[model samples]
Target: MTTIPVTDLLGSLRSGNSTAPRLTWYGPDSERVELSGRVLDNWVAKTSNLLQDELDAEPGMRLRLALPAHWKALVWALAGWQVGLETVLDGGPADFLATDDPAGAVEQHDAVIAVALPALAMRWTGELPAGCFDYAADVRSHGDVFMPHSDPDPSACAVRTQEGRIIRHRELISGFALPHTEGARLHIPADKGLESALANALGAWQQDGSVVLTHPDVALTGKLLADERIHGS
Candidate 1:
């Protein structure tokens, strides 16, 4: 019997032992977009290549940027960790509203940063400033392979603020833990209007070593079952 920690997911990704399914991205217009696994793989590959190519000079650092509700945003963020780069998500558009222009926004931050602007904003800011990388194009390049400079610490992540970026240096998810063993089955108890019970059960299951799977809507048991795709039985 083997118990696996939540952190193992990151390791499995780095070792090429696993890949994540497409995370659905919901946009502001009530539109949903699904990015393919191949796109994620390529972005990760490109990021790895870029990290190796730039290590002697830039040595990638934590990222800071605002992203639209696009699936590519997830790819970019994950790609950062894939190459041992830290990533900070934008607080929100209100923070961006403070700036008079993109250049001003770029100058306000101390470190090299990449931003994903709204379609209108991207058109307004014709080209990226020198030394700044276009986050989207860089992640999309197909030929590059990401060779990490160091093993990514699962705890390494960042948060954005109007003032600047703060490194959390810890895994971001809170409130629940997911644990697993190779050949056992487990269930996330129906919410039953008991959030605490679900949390406690999840914690105990994680503690006792059980694979956990969940979905956004607890009513849809069929969807939840389909998504669990792993459980190596």
Candidate 2:
């Protein structure tokens, strides 16, 4: 078994369990979205292409994620990491910012992205700032398979936060001792921050398993949990 970096884990999942559910998301409006490993990888690929081709996003670029704990938000974060961009959670300086609110972005950002968390809508339908682009709309035109323009050094910094810690891809993946194996379906709450939630979810994926994402805001009963076949409480 080869110990691959977190960046390569998604590709492994796509090839190993292409049709399995990689993530199942529920919105506050009782809307549900299920993305298989292949589908999720397609989205990530498209998003990476959008960032690299259109926005001129390069590896080592700092990106601030201002979206909520939605599935698309996680996809964008993974896409950024795939492009070798550092995902900044701590309100630090960033080269680009992806947010639901254009006004919330800092003035120093070179690019601003508006993400509309649409349940069934494919793209954002509202107006945006002159320079800001709608993520959903723009990503539709990109290719489904992404090829990195330039490979990044694996030992280089992959993520940084106001926590004053920088982590590399190998370190982040190796740090978590996940017990999930291939096709494991793990359930997690949305109360966790993006970093924590993604860490656990990706850890599950690291084992070639999928994640059943849930939220405290959404009413979840024992029946619903059982219906999803969630293994544990």
- List TM-scores for all candidates, in order: 0.46, 0.91
The C-alpha stretches of model 2 lying farther than 4 A from their native spots are: 1-4, 104-106, 176-183
Estimate candidate 1's alpha-carbon lDDT, on a 0 to 1 scale: 0.39
Model 2 root-mean-square deviation: 2.5
User: Which runs in model 1 stand beyond 4 Å of their true positions?
Assistant: 1-21, 26-32, 51-60, 89-101, 108-125, 142-144, 153-233
1-233 per-residue lDDT for model 1 (tens digits): 12123223333433442343333332343333433344445655665554445423122354543543233443444455455454444443321111113454645443233545342333224665555555444434435454444555544443333345443434332423333343233443322212222233334333332323222243434554566542332
Q: For model 2, how does the per-residue alpha-carbon lDDT over 1-233 read when each residue is reduced to its tens digit?
A: 22227557777867976997889987777878999889999989999999999998887788888776779888988888888888888878889899888864546689998888876667777667677788877888999988888775566666675485787756667753345665567887777766766777777888777787776677778887887777764
Poorest 10 consecutive residues of model 2 by lDDT?
1-10
Q: What is the Å distance of residue 165 in model 1 from its true position?
A: 12
What is residue 155's positional error in candidate 2, in angstroms? 1.8
Name the lDDT of candidate 2: 0.78
Clashes of 1: 5
For candidate 2, report its TM-score. 0.91
lDDT of 1 at 147: 47
Q: What's the true lDDT of residue 188 in model 2? A: 71
